[model samples]
Target: MNKANPIRIQRYLSGVDYPQTRDGLVRAAEHNGADAPTLEALRGLPDRMYEGPSGVSAEIGGDS
Candidate 1:
């Protein structure tokens, strides 16, 4: 699940810039058609800078 999740998350972050804050990632994901689970996970993320999906994946318990 972890392995596949990042791949799915990537689809929503393809055009987003790196080093995004939690809010930025959520907004970006929403703009790119992220689903409820994705948005919920983003909302639960820590308030900090993130380089890419890997960091977000880790927060959601992915093996990043």
Candidate 2:
């Protein structure tokens, strides 16, 4: 997996609502256009519910 564009990560997760689990978020990100690296980053995050894109980003090492 290649490195991902941090800014686009949020846009890809647009369809997902808050309180989504890491697995669910990863699926949504895939459905919305996230690449392999982005998916990998999401997968690497701690297993928990995310409140929003920022939460996902923060866990994936973004400047949220």
State which candidate has the highest lDDT: 1
Cα lDDT of model 2 by residue, 1-64, tens digit: 3345656777778878788998998899899888777788777778888887777665665453
Q: For residues 1-54, could you state the per-residue lDDT of candidate 1 as single tens digits?
A: 212365677788778888899899889989999998777777777799998767
lDDT of 1 at 27: 94
| TM-score of each prediction | 0.77, 0.77
What's the residue-level lDDT of 31 in candidate 1? Answer: 93
Candidate with best TM-score: 1
Residue 64 CA error for candidate 2 (Å)?
Answer: 8.9
